[model samples]
Target chain A: MKKLWWKDKFNIFMAAIAYLTLLFIIAAIGTVIMKGFPHIGKSLATPEIQFAVKLSLYTSLISTVLCIVIAIPVAFVLARVDIPFKSLFNTLLDLPLALPPVVSGVCLLLFFGTTAFGAWLEEIGLPFVFTIKGIIIAQIFVNLPFMIRVMKSTILSVSPRLEFIARTLGCTPTQAFWKITLPLSRNGIIAGTVITWARALGEFGAALMLAGATRFRTETLPISLFLNMSTGDLEEAMAAANLLIIISIISLYIFNKLGGDFIGGTRGV
Target chain B: MIKLADVSITLGDFSLKNVHLEIRKGEFFTILGPTGTGKTVILELIAGLYRPDAGKVLINGADSENIPPEKREIGFVYQDYALFPHLNVYKNIAFGPRLRKMPPSAIKENVQGLADMLEITHLLARFPGTLSGGEQQRVSLARALIMKPKILLMDEPLSALDPNTKRMLCGELKRVHEKYRCTVVHVTHDFNEAAMLADRIGVILKGKVKQVGVPREVFERPRDQEVKNFLGVEPLKAVYAR
Candidate 1:
């Protein structure tokens, strides 16, 4: 069969776009490896690097758990409840995503520094400036919007009638949430947690500014990489970058595989 | 008897104004109306899913306004079946009794008994997503009936079924009503279904009860032209003059 001329042009245009996209992605990966891989083995195994990695993983995990525990309920209220000023609540939750990471860090610092509330916290024996706690607080602030947005969409996709049916069947509101709503939205929660954890893990500007990047103390992996690069320790910086890349890729892959089910379940109407 | 005395509610895009209804115990009452006529809203109001803006709902001469849905002693089945996709048929049927803190043995017996009644015993272990439309409908019915509520409100329960399944389920529903002697207020837009199952038929239009009587009375002796047209029994020739 003879092909139409426009069809050939359309195919060529589509091929060009796909090719460029793949090329861009490959270029990014090549650049990271070329600049970072040579020092991976020894630097990754070093005690300081190991400590930073462990601390970073643990803190990000904690921050992610805290963010999800708080954000899921907030997202549900935003999506499902008839709270007053609902638009305002949604805008405030999304503000962090729009702000730069350093701006977020500054805002956290001002709120949690030796200001009045921070002083009150200090008096209560809960200081959160230039400490590991500050790092977690910063991560939570930066990653919260992603978790909330994911969870809000997920909860919105569920028909409210299902919960109503459960309620009529004698389940309390809380029981219905746990037994019906939560299980139905499991894929969204999982995808959101993965994305939030990845975001928390790679947090740099906020963690450095708020946590002070002190070696063997408040230094998370991203902060360590920044500190190392600034001090001309190229090998250590490259190793940390490589490790971050590896972790991010694996997390994103799993997120894509599982997140597909969530999006697929809600595709047309 | 469940009675709605001068009930009024203004939901978005729909309103029920001075809507009055009395569903007698052990009677199969069908609320027949076109889409957006507030048939489902009436069921929701009775089930305590929505509070009326005005008037009172009395169940056996007691006000039901303060009672939450779980305590309202009413069972509701939605048009979409609303089966818990996460739960298998058995768990879905067992949910109400479990929530009531019934003993495990009793819960099992009630669920199995209802499943057997609906001929859904083979599908108990399967999740709702795995069941056919007819199977899901039966499972939903079983779940609602296992609660043994004071009354049952079904919102267009057979609207989603294929014609053959709908016919079969209509017969099965009649049998179920006879066996349990449970009062049923079934909502449907189909005139044939109303004629087949309802002891009394109420035609709702624009949120008002235009007519309520036995099915033959509403069909053969409609009080208004709207009810006659709605029942699809009007002559094909035009009756209006400009």
Candidate 2:
């Protein structure tokens, strides 16, 4: 072989940089598993830890379902209809994705904890402050924008020409959407659902602020980890971190099984 | 019968300015034009897909402005056929009838009868993505015709096919029209296709109809230089005798 030139050496350096990041991630995850995997059995048997796991699953599942039900119509409107101030509305919708989770939680608190609307909601016996309902609301708030982003791209991939043709076939606008647009968006919807569920499961700062760190009451996985770390309980903290990592891996595996367009709903008809 | 009187629409950079036409009942009227001249917009206007900015569209002595496309009862055949990819050919043809809540037995009868007539009975089980261009067009026809639309609008329906398929489908189109006996408003750029199929032809240039009459009259007696340029005809002479 000829002598390696500077360009070839630089390319090798780039590959090494990629491998370095990959290695860093693997080592970090390895540390977590090595420290926590053995204690997982005992930690999970704790009543508070069991409640945290149940609450995380329960809230994320409900939020994922609500996100999908709301995202379909919202994405269709953004993709197809020409609403005035659409760009402004879109920016507002995407605000949750850009802002810190704590700031969003603060905003939610100001609206639902102290304002007239909060008073009205409390009067109706439907409160969302320092309760399990507050945790579900926080999860939905954090993940709905992402679900809509994925779903909107998927809807955009479907041709408006198909809907135009359906109109001439004696179907109303709503009927056309039901028959044509929704079916073509099946892959995108599945992808959005998976990603939303994963993100909701890992929700932290908003839940911590809004739902409070009450044990056996509103503790989700991330909140459980935070509360356990605060009290210097290494075993419980490690257990929480390991469980989250395993869940993230499972979510990624399901995405791999689904093949392409798992994140953006970009499949076309 | 259908008519567009002083119809105008401004969409972004292109505009149809004061266009007019009168398509009689059961007549095959073809609007011939060059590309990018808004030929498709006229067909869409009549189909109620696009509303005119400042004119009246009368359908059989009724003002059709307030009617939406679903209520217009006009069938549109896109250039690319616009078949639903998820549904197989059988369900695609049965879609309109299903929307009407027709019984399964009647839907099967109509779908199978139309499929046999279109020579696509064997392809019913296949999805649209697997079929060739000609087959997709034929299925599109069966789908639209099953609704029994009284006014059919076609926008370059044969433009996407190969030359041989185009010629064959042109014949099939005429046969379908005769069997249906509906008013047809076909927009195309091919002079041969218009001459072969149209009872009367309209020449559109720069968003206006320059001439509308019999094909022989419009061809032999050119309206102006623009119309002649659009025709782009040349005489063939035999130089060598065999």
Candidate 3:
């Protein structure tokens, strides 16, 4: 059957919007690749750049792992159990996502940098100001919301009846969660972890404010890009930007591959 | 024996008020009610999944207020089976015994025996998602049976099956009940299911037990206007026509 003009018009309009969005992304990324490809050899040879890359990888990995560890229980509680101030808890948890990255970093600095508790922590040898630990702390603070959001939605998709069945079969509440709930939410958990890692990797303003963009000390990939660009070293900055773009594309690809089912809701029994 | 004495609970819009019931040992008790009448709530309460807002639930003449579902030695089968989709049939059946820390050898023996009894030995390697409704139903029964629970609670276990599948499984259910003599409290909206499997039936409407008696008595002679109206709409014999 021949389609109607009006019917095809809506389809064409939607396609136009999608293509326009894609065009913007490709243009933005194409400029960096064209400019940065030639400088890749020199940019990678720098000790400072290498240090930033290594530090970013390790810190993001640690923070992502920590986010998963904390998110599992928090997601389960939010998904399953009832609490007194649940709305309050949800609002507080989501506040980080709403705040600007720089503002969040400033808030973290005030709380953990100059406070008496921060002093006590320093006394115990765990400092969170202008250090690698500060970078990790900031990454976790920024990425935790993504972890919780994905994990909570995934946990909610799994039926509580499965846990009830487990409990009836002589497994405790904790056992039920570990055996049934966790394994069931595996796909979502993986997707969440990848998204959290990607978010942490791309974190910049927070890392700069909290860790202070040092030369070879606490510099991350984004910090490296900024520091290089500040000295009019556009090639190295573009190189760093291209690297970030490549990592992001890879992360996004993995998320899309694993996330179709995660977003579609729970797997069928 | 299983008993609910003055049990009252308010869940969202539904509330059960001063409910009382007595189910004897080895009896197939069916709580007959329409959908959304809190039939599953009663089963959960008996299984210790939900605590009653007021009064006591007594299992074997002991107050079960403090006992958790894990310690209750009960088996619950949901309408949708609630099988672990990640595990194959073998692991799903063996989950309970493994959780109890039983030896590997004993778990294998118990699971194998139950699988044979339920005629699901061929489905042991398949996942629940691949199985037909009837096959999944049998696997669910096997999973619950392997635990050898003191009481088995089924919440519309066969309601999701087709007519033929439902009929076949109902026969299997009767056979299993007769062989094990496990006290079962099966809740359903279908009166024909209650008539076929129940030694006694309790008419529940809006979380209230209107009548409790043998199937014939509950079917032929409802005690109250509400029970009469509920059963009056659909005759018991007509439900078995298909």
Candidate 4:
């Protein structure tokens, strides 16, 4: 069999890189699976673990919803409107993504802990420190950039002509957005939501700093794992870590599938 | 009943400087130009998509600068047929009326009427993505026409179709224009299309209306070198050799 000279070295190198990447990913996944699954069933069934799981799910869902509601308008403005200092707004939106989660937690704590703004918030019965609400705020702050980026691209991908057509068809600007822009961008919206929800679900450092690791109160899964590790209970810590790993895997799988659907559907359009 | 008075626009590098033109009610007017001549900008200006940097756009004798595109009561068909890909043909056609909050029965009747007129009744259940290029164009035209807009603006609507489909749709468009009796501003780079479809042709070169006249007048009698070349006026072989 004759082989082309160009294919000989380059092909083998590319194949080796691909195989190594695949092997690394498989190894990471296998380790998580091996350590996490056995503890998941019992922990998930226990009342304390169940409450933490339930709270995590509930808060993340709410935070995801809130992020979407806030992000869509901001994304639209960023994508379509000629706002002042657009680059600044874009940079600010992406800042959280670049910042370490622990730093973000600290920043949130300073902004909302006993400061003038925090005092005002407290007076209004809306304090955001060491509360369940603080967890949601942290998740929202971290997840907002992901949603905004997704929505901005989605909105950008759609031709402005379609909206113009809608308006010419007698839809008010709001109506055009609701009927045309929203429906056309449904896939991107869902994909963004899933990814944002997953990010919120796995949120650890910010939740730890802002909400604190109070058992059965503000203790999310990551906090539970941290508390277990600090207490020198390796089995419980490993169990909690394993449970989180399982959830992350399941959520990631769904996100990948849905994200593909969103991207593929829009491309065909 | 659409008039533009000294409309000037600067869209990045291409600029329309002091452009003036008018389309009377029930007339099929075409803007014939080369690519990047800002012909579509004229239609968009009239449709209120872009506010002119200078001058006025009048719809039915009213200054329409403040009017939104949706409120302009004009229907536009883009070059790519910009149909809502998520919507089926029936819904796409019904969009305008539904936005207007016309009764469901009226919307259905109007959609069916336009669908029947365009011979796209069978494809009404299919999404725009599933439709052929010709089918998508027809559906786009139907969607625009069903609104019964005061003026219909089409920007190279048939450019995406096959030549045969283009020819066929041209006839259909003429018939539709006749039935509706609406003023039309059609932008196309194809001289043949302009000649076939225009009641009056406005020749735009580099964003300015170089000349405006009937098809025969613009084509047969070349006023300038640019207009002559645009009309494909090849000098006789002997004259060229000379």
TM-score of 4: 0.93
Write candidate 1's Cα lDDT for A32-97 as tens digits: 789889878889888879988999999999999999999889988988889999998889888988
**For residues A1-269, could you state the per-residue lDDT of candidate 3 as single tens digits?**
98675468788898889999999989989999999988888988888778878998999999999999998889888888898899899999989988899998998898888899999998899998999999999999988876787889889888888888988888888888889999988888887787789889889878778888888888888998998899888977887898898888877777767764665532220
What TM-score fits each model? 0.94, 0.93, 0.95, 0.93
lDDT of 2 by residue, B50-150 (tens): 89999989999899998889888888898889999999999999999999999999999999999998899999999999999999999998999999999
Which residue pairs of candidate 2 clash?
A: none
Tens-digit lDDT string for candidate 4 (B27-100): 99999999989999999999888999999998889999899887787889988889998888899998888877
Binned by DockQ into CAPRI classes (incorrect, acceptable, medium, high), candidate 3 is high
**Model 3, B1-242: lDDT tens per residue?**
99999999999988998899999999999999999999999999999878999989999999999999999888888888889899999999999889888999999999889888888999999999999878988899899999888799999999989999898899899999998899999999987898888999999998899999988888888897889989875566733432
Give the runs in model 4 whose Cα sits over 4 Å from its true position. A1-10, A260-269, B234-242
Best by DockQ: 3
lDDT, residue B181, candidate 3? 90
Q: Can you write out model 1's per-residue Cα lDDT over B1-242, one digit (the tens) per residue?
A: 99999999999978999999999988999999999989999999999888999999998899999888988878898888999888888999998898889999999988888888788999988999999989999999998998887799999999999999998999899999999899999999987788888899899999999999987777778898887777776532211110
> If both were scored by DockQ, which would come out higher, candidate 2 or candidate 3?
3
True lDDT of residue A198, candidate 3: 82
Model 1 regions lying over 4 Å from their true place: A1-7, A260-269, B234-242
Which residue pairs in candidate 4 collide? Answer: A167-B70
Who is ahead in lDDT, 2 or 4? 2
Q: Which ten residues in a row are the worst by lDDT in model 1 chain A? A: A260-269
